[model samples]
Target: MTVFILVGGVFTGADVWRETAARLAAAGREAHAVPLTAIDAGRPAVGHVDLETHIADVTAAIDAVGEGPGREIVLVGHDYGIHPALGAADRRPQRVDRVVYLDCGMPRDGVPPLAAVPDPALRARLAARAGRGETQGELAPPATHEEWQRWGSTAGVGVAALDRLTALAAPQPLGTLLQPLRLSEAVAAVPATGVLCTRNGVGIDLVQRLVDFGDPVAAALAGPRVTFFELPTGHWPMLSCPAELADVLLRAAAGAGHRLRPADTGTPPAHLRPFPLDVPEVPRDRKGHVDLYVPGEGGARPAVVFVHGGPVPAAARPTPRDWPTLVGYARLAAAEGVVGATLDHRLHDVADYERAAADVTAAVELVRADPRVDADRIALWFFSGGGLLAAPWLAEPPAWLRCLAASYPVLEPPPGWGLGDSRFRPVRAVAHAGALPVVLLRAGREAPGIAATVEAFVAAAKDSGARLELVDVPHGHHGFETLDPAEETGPPLRHAMRAVVTRLTG
Candidate 1:
């Protein structure tokens, strides 16, 4: 059988599935990782490559790989790649023998990919980002390590393998996320399997939850023709647990008639459970709420407060407490035996940088007052816009503040955004950073202006005797935390988060 592997969304190329392909090839199966037109080496795709374009790309790959008369094509799709995989199967059911949906959305006719996202807020956020003119409808990756890991589990992969995948990820075109898959009912006839990396069945439960909430794709996975197989890993099993994923794929391809196994029904780890939401820090204020996630066996644990990116237009701002990525990271931190707190601060238009700083300060006080939290050990994590607001704290941080982490932070105003305002220049704080340790995580592929500002800050911090460490994500872009976190970027994100947690807890 000729196995055609299609990778997930974003700037990802076929290289994301290299391990799975090589393993299948070693097992004596014909395997090919098909690169989509948007990411193909020599194709050089231009503006707005839609679903049809992707379908054509996959169709051509299928035709090229299934050239032999006797060869049977097994189509495999990961994440957003499922749309094209199914589209190809619908277009050439006679040529395709099996279809595998690997921890991805299983799209049907008419519904676009973004419309199928279970969360309405997330769908809107994606659309809003696309509508922003200068961005040209391109979405960057998740901006932080915690957000990246929360997007997918990468516990099973080695550092080298994860890094290789991260290096290959690119900025995804918005059209691909918005395009509807043109699939036909005939696709049902092709043998299909839904390979879920549930990490001890949480994925299964989440799917069932979405189905209960009326998600059509989740509802379709519950269909009779689709066999569900669970793998105890994160979303990107091809990178996290490739050997086992390959085994399952090979078994399905060989027509072994495998069935869904009994999933682990034990209590999920603390981090995976639903954390307490909308706990008020400032009881009288409507927007002064915070979400807290605590580890199962916690006892006066250290805490890390997450400050989200923004200062965005009021009309487009989201309630930070409800953000899935932030909430997930809080839960993940709790799972790691740290108290994770995600807070909401005033927007730039509503309050100056000082007011935002005060909001974070109030949040820290609230956390410190909690009986379950270690009052003496606390850390602050800032992303993008939040980085500027954190300047005062970084300059003259409280004795109790253990560490500070900033990811792709806007330490200085963009050239056109009132650079004359010293209030917004976080670089000035470097001289006052003192002996307090700071972790600065930057994307190597960010805008030149942002890179230059960060470079200046790093140089200044070093000369000022501030104990600072810089972690570089070579292939990532600005706001990576909000983008699709692929296997390649997971390790660095995890590493950065762990370092912060260690410093604060120690």
Candidate 2:
């Protein structure tokens, strides 16, 4: 027999798990939903309730359930609930078989939930409230559906559920979000499951990409015991799809979710797949920082600079210039009678974008100085995460810069990236690109958050009357050149590439 323990997120109580709990019970599993100190409806919340207080609540639930022979426990936590759940699990690893992270980021040591609050205005307001000692040192729940969106997407939730959620919402103690969650080495021994909510912006494919990019945090998730599952609904799956959530929890407990394979394990990773078009490789000139592939041994011709997207791990082998996609594109451009250049930038993390931009600028200068390249005619093409690097060039176009192009580019940084006020926002910077020709290749099946940024950039481009040419790959995914090799992707990719090459040479 397996006993399941559920912990709710901020402003929520055990009652939110009612429907899901019933389903679990019907399936012959015992489920207990822990009502933490601040949000318990049976009693008034004390002003000083904190994360430790919630951890105690969960530990108490575990004790009452009583671990014994033939009886195991699966600890499940949703959003902010993951903090206390992790703390309690760390304290009683012997009693926990698995810890399910439900629609939330993996909690880090010494970092509070408040630090990652998605809404800037709300985060500032909460800090101000705490500073002023208001609301009895508590943070109130969102009052309306619109307000709730700041927390997470409400794609699959209903009006009735939303109303009930608001009515049952309690004020969360400020300390719960402010206090850092402490864990021990014991928690790492227990296997883990990640339940991602796709509509809210995260999905298994995106997680896989992050792991492939050599992100340390994401890499940690590729451990053998950590598995993943993605739900099509939004943040609050317990409310939106309780039955499905219950099923997933049951499946997770049985260790039946998808396992992630690290990039090294793949013979050649997805991004390293063979290029769609067969073009002979042109010998690369690696004299400077930028790798240059000149067309013919003749007069200087126009150039196209290709930027590979990443906050890619600095340690990943076979640098960007050697990637099959990048190398193939460069070869293709050279075969088409133009110079193609690729450079490895230092976008090792989100915070390093500024440094990466400097590397790119320096590489451009080096590429321009090459006698084989026509310095006055150049087009810059960016991909994926490198999309943000285009902002400065877009905001203030140079005389030698003829055009800009991006494939499945992230136009704006997502929340919690600490780039809210960054100048790297192409959605905002596109407005400043008065006469600059911009080519955008959009992936229809892109991750929701990234797709939203692309849409915003498109809207901004329209509003500004920017010289933008859009190519839509309706059935493609991000890294479509390698991920989706269907004929549909071929046409749009070539069209976008041609659009840039023509602008550079014409």
Candidate 3:
């Protein structure tokens, strides 16, 4: 695999990617540090570059790599480099295998980089400079070590590296910052990953803030194709954590050939093993523990929290940590390139809905804190009796939650299940179901009592304008996967699983 590195704005030359490129080369991969034409160290970029010019520069680099059948290229873009890299990918989708956005803004069709700038004054100034026919303008960097520390660059980069960056900094083309990025839907099809710099405080929340502020680039970042990895460093990972960054790039490249969408048919990938982490959120009891399934891959992946059915006899109820069906689901999720977690919440008899909700909350926090998991792209999967406890999440879901799935769920409060707690009623929770999409899987031959409740809950959710997708299993019954894993039930169960996976990943 050939990895193409694009440096950020206001920085000239490919020197910034030297450490990262050397690391990739050591791993037996070819790395190309492609320099932007007008933004180079050889001369002043006073009147020579724009968005189109940089796009052309990247396009030339892609051409030089010699694209053909079975030839794979991974585009790595840092900060402002994202614009040109995406534009090049849009122009050459078949040639580019994957695109990685490193602590940068992801561009959408017709949205300029200036539009996504958080500060209105800076945005207006850049726009005005472009309008005034200024070919280039200096993007001032921190002049002093104290200012550099305040900017979060000194945390990861040493004095020498910081000095090198300062020496290599160049003036950026005003027109390039102002030019609207023209991308096609084909760019969306390319597998994409975002390397978030957490130590610099840049993560999913920052992306969401941009989305909430109506930035198109931020909106695109929220899409399904973009998986995320968190690096515990400042913005300049190339200078500070090159080996780690190279490993992340390698993992991304390895998975680039797989289809972004979950397979509709076929046995899952072979290596479905998970690295388990047992977290005791409540007490020493097994019911208070949560098991996180980290994929064998090296980079961060999205997460799914599995909540199992319960409130039965202790011997009859399977332990959440060792349940075969849940473990199989987690393995399946890992095979599909996502982190999976099975959590144990308090049984209904031991506590009310509030306590169960608290357990789920704790599980979510645990998942978010894992370095191998993307805190933003999390989904909650509730099965059978556990759905009621997850009702609060559906009622007022967090912004980071992508979507949720419930299979053969007990949405309505049964007579003894809730212990007379009114808050356990999932039917009432529908009214507060925010815009988060929900997948409801209903077994066709379910018990009449359970079927009636599911129907009532579905009706209420529809009336409340909740986004819902219902998958009906025509020949299966409740807990079909556990009770009967034969041909009769396997197809429908897999179908429901695929649907939920698609919704969650997307």
Candidate 4:
């Protein structure tokens, strides 16, 4: 028989797991919910409760269960709860047979939950309160239903359940989030299961894609001992789908979830696969920081500078310039009687957008300076995460800049990304776009979080009355240029390119 221990997130108590525990007990399984030092008992002694207090609470739960032969224990952690669960498991590695990371990012050692707080305003306020010598500091729970979504997707949670969740909410200890989780090498041997919640923006497919993209952390998760399961609901599976969640927890304890394969870096990832286009290949000028594809028959032609998206890992092979999508777009532009350019920008991390923007500016200058390029007739095209780089160009379009285009762009940073800068928010910046032509290609099947950003940008653009031309690829994914087949993605891809070209020359 497997015993399960559940740890709830900030602002939650053991009471939050009542339904799930009952379901588990009905299935003849033992279940325990750890009430953290400050969270379950209401908002008293706020600063007195740090991460160690909660870790101790979990350790005590483990002790009560006790370790013996033929006994198995599964520790489940959700959101902020994962920290203490990991800390306790690190201390009692022999007791915990498996650790379930429920609907949360993989927390790393020495990184506090404060670092991953999704809301910018809340994160800033928390930082201010914690940075001060406020011994009584605590974060109040969301008072409204809409505010609850800031923590995670609340889909499938009914009005009554949400009201109960809000009414029972307790202020979280500031210290709990401030302190980091410490782990030892011994815990690495414990098998792990990840329960992904699709509505909260993370799913198994995205994880596998990240692994395929050469992310070291994602690679580590692809190890044999790590398995995955996906719930088609929101973040709080306990409240939204308790029975299903209980069933998943049981299967996870038995190590019956989906296993991920290691990324084969040798083969190009799906996003980097040959762009779904059959354009004639044009010779690329590989000598400069920008790869330029000059038209075969024209001189001083309009140029379109294609900016590839990513906080792509610094270690990712074959760089953006070599990606088939960018290469294909540039060659296709050259084939259409225009100069096309692509560059390798250093957007190697979530926090490097400013630096990436600088790289883009320099690349555009390099492209405009080329002898065969008509500097006054140039368009800037951005893709993927590179979409944020379009902010400055959108906010204040230059006389020489003719048009701006983005394909499946991330117009706004998702809350979890911790991007607090206002300069990178295109949704906010598009209001200042004036009459500059804007072409946006949206992916219908984009990741939920990213799709939200796109929709917000479109709404903002429409409200501002910007010269926006929108194209929807009803069946396309995020990197649709390479992810979807040509028949599905080609029309929009060429149409967006043509729009930019028309703005440049017409």
Candidate 5:
């Protein structure tokens, strides 16, 4: 397929392209991460900062990549890297697949890298920081993540580079910034993908709004040459939410939908609340409230409460992109004679993965407060990322919740980061399992890191007094039931969910 020459910017490395590269490699494509600004960490950094030189470097890199047999190249720019990336793309539009911008869209020509074209918040953040001397400020010592600490200490690069940059860097020749490079020709010929990281609090809806604001510029792009995908995370998501960040980048490159949660848990267990016309929660989670399919024909069945996942506190939404078909879980539970009620947990401020394991405790409380649910037999069935949120409670969940189940769960720092498995390292969540039985499920051909995370969790939980079961299934992928049409179009695929529910409530 097409090749990608990634142009990383100042203050960031090529790390953002890691996951995308890996996925492309896996899919049999070529990708290269081109690093720049080797502008010395010490003084003389000013002399090294040259836009024209950087542009030449990109053109050179493309020529090198194309050496023997040339393939289409997409020169991607991130942050300030756009100045050079766009310039190179303009000089050699024939070789460029598309000049795709991440977070920062196409900046108008003649304006400095610091100029404002669209996205008011981004402009404001940059202006405030630059004004406060972030660019010209003295080089401060670097404090970085533990893993990177050693490398950073050795490299001795951090904030000081900014000071060096400001003191000696060239005043970007104004023409490049002010001139809107003619995209109508190349935009129509080349394919481009715009990855808007929602990590900045900009979701799909917000992305649409921003696009509407830039409609004039967009119309000039010419034809269906560009695409956009929102990664709901942060500005520096590669550092904060790397695994999720990687997933998003891969989705953009592959032209595929992000993974979704599974739906329809076969015949719901008997202990679920029947689909109630009157509804249960009545007010706060009106759109999200559902009946519990209680098991057995008894007056008071051990009711199961369902809690879905959001980044932190679960806000109930009428259009839950993942589990709309959770309705099937309830229908099955009702038929089985159990009460099944799904709820939204209480984490609102959390924006990253560290709180993933910790949020389970709060979810337990929300599920327990329910009147229809039986405190003794409550069970948790979570999917994909939900499993990360659910893992903490597996060891000794509340007295009410009796079982824990998760499918295609992410266990820790994830593979691309190679921080190893954190799922088994029970710190804050160790005390949670008051003796809840746990189940961890995985599709046979899962990505390497997830498999490792699950294995680590199994090993860690081995002697924790909690029962653990690993179910390796025949069909599915991450969030397969939710994202894959094969699973959603038919009834056979719901069998896996039924299998988990059967063990939990039957």
Candidate 6:
């Protein structure tokens, strides 16, 4: 039998993996814990890691084990470590009997792993501060309670040391973080299991049981050839509930031997092979993939594009909380006989929004290239953070746009708009204008200082003879609470969006 390799995740060290290895060793089973350089958030001395590097490290461990003894291996990935495990397993599927994901899952095709978390702005902010690298792709953790506190209390490490570590940390490749894991078809066929730590849901303030189960680790419960078990502990079960965690893993391992193959219940209609007909079909990047869901229309239709903001390569990474808003917005635009495209633009803290504006302009060119699209009739609709990326255009409207409808647009990047330094430095950055018709929406309860920025943009557009429709919105930071109707939220922002869309397009 080969050994089971445990891959350590964010802020987690060999010690975390060691705990599991110790348990496995005590059980008289072969196991090897592999730690690939992401622990020590305070000391990001190690170079940056995309899944590829992490994958290489784990694959080397398996090869080392295989060379030493001919033991069948079962791989384990905890937290961010799952990236490397999946990458490695994709290479050696048969040699490994199973791959166990312990609370760590990567985006499957288009979205980046870190980008999938709903409202992950907080985490992304921390990753940059913690020196995890620019892409926020690396994870080695204080995944457990003690670990989190330890990081907070580690004041002894000199600030100089911290700075040095941060300098050593590297940036994530543009697309890998959002590029979705590319796996051999064989890897998906492998029997895998997920062990979820419920501590996450508890801390999150409002995660339901089903939502927790839908997590990557929990996705196994619904995905084929995979099983899921949730534990009410922090993200790291090894430290929070090692004994129970071990037991769950052992049982899941036992269950893996019994493959479930039954008669088919039913077959899907041809139109629904993978998804619904309204799904927006967009073009792909180098990987030949696009995250936007554009409806398939046999004839030409007016086209509209969606450009998301993150200043990160995988800007289009899906947000769990925004599913309703995105789908609804897409549906609304599609119903208007228009093609919708949500673009994944390049991002960085030191990003030049003007460059992003140019990127959006190129995307518009692409949309215009297709005969299926009425290039001259395109409408630009965006709100909240996405509005920031397009704000630069208000002064210098993109040449191809039919018109621009923006809500709560932040004309300039606020002092701390997630980027360490301000990229939208007033004058030089935002110079888009010239008799363009535009609609501006602002949250009534927006941050005091932010309102000025919004006003400035509106003023600039007006100064340039652009038609500005100012609508006072009674809402919060992101306007997602409005898109998904069935969802219950405090106020109604959807009404605000509808009003803006109607004024801009109608």
Backbone clash count, each prediction separately: 13, 0, 0, 1, 62, 29
Determine which window of 10 residues in candidate 4 has minimal summed lDDT: 413-422
C-alpha TM-score for every candidate: 0.48, 0.82, 0.47, 0.86, 0.51, 0.41
* lDDT tens readout by residue for model 1, 60-166: 88777735665778888876788878888899898888898887655768877765443334566876765673233556655443334434455566777666666
The lDDT, on a scale of 0 to 1, for candidate 3 is 0.68
The residue ranges of model 3 lying beyond 4 angstroms of the native Cα positions read 43-47, 117-120, 131-142, 146-154, 204-224, 256-506
Indicate whether candidate 3 or candidate 4 has the larger TM-score.
Answer: 4
**Local distance difference test scores for all models:** 0.68, 0.86, 0.68, 0.86, 0.48, 0.51
Q: Could you give the candidate ranking by lDDT, starting with the highest?
A: 2, 4, 3, 1, 6, 5
Report how far residue 304 has shifted in candidate 3, in Å: 36
**Which stretches of candidate 6 lie above 4 Å from their native place?**
38-49, 67-70, 116-119, 122-180, 202-224, 256-506
User: Counting only residues 3 or more apart in sequence or on different chains, how many pairs clash (N, Cα, C under 3 Å) in candidate 4?
Assistant: 1
Question: Between candidates 2 and 5, which one is better according to TM-score?
Answer: 2
Model 3 C-alpha lDDT per residue in residues 1-506, reported as the tens digit of each score: 55555555444468888888998899988888877765676533545567888888788888888656556898988867888889999998988888988876556788887664433445567778877867465556546555444323334788898888777766566667788899988888998888877655344433443343334334555556666777777668898899999988888777631222222224321112222222222211122477776667677778888887654223323445565567767766766667778877765432345677787889889888888788888888888767787677877788888878888887875432213334667788877877887888888877555676799889999899998888877766666664543566556556656766676677
Give per-residue CA lDDT, model 2, range 1-506, as digits (tens): 88899999878899999999999999999999998886987756655787888989999888888657978899999989999999999999998999999998888878777765776657778677656755347677889877777677777899999998888989888888877788878898999999998777667987887787667778878899999999988889999999999999999999989988886785777877888777876998895668999877988888999998887878777778889889888887888789999999999866778899999999999888888889999999999989999999999999999999999998887543546677888998999999899999999888877888999999999999999999999988888888886587778877887888888878
* lDDT (C-alpha) at residue 405 in model 5: 66
Candidate 1: list runs displaced more than 4 Å: 67-70, 116-122, 129-136, 142-144, 200-224, 257-506
* Tens digit of per-residue lDDT, candidate 4, span 370-424: 7899999999999988898899999888988999999989898654455544588
Q: Please give the distance, in angstroms, between residue 291's alpha carbon in candidate 3 and its true position after superposition.
A: 40
| Of 3 and 5, the candidate ranking higher by lDDT | 3
For this target, which candidate reaches the highest TM-score against the unseen true structure? 4
Give the C-alpha lDDT of model 2: 0.86
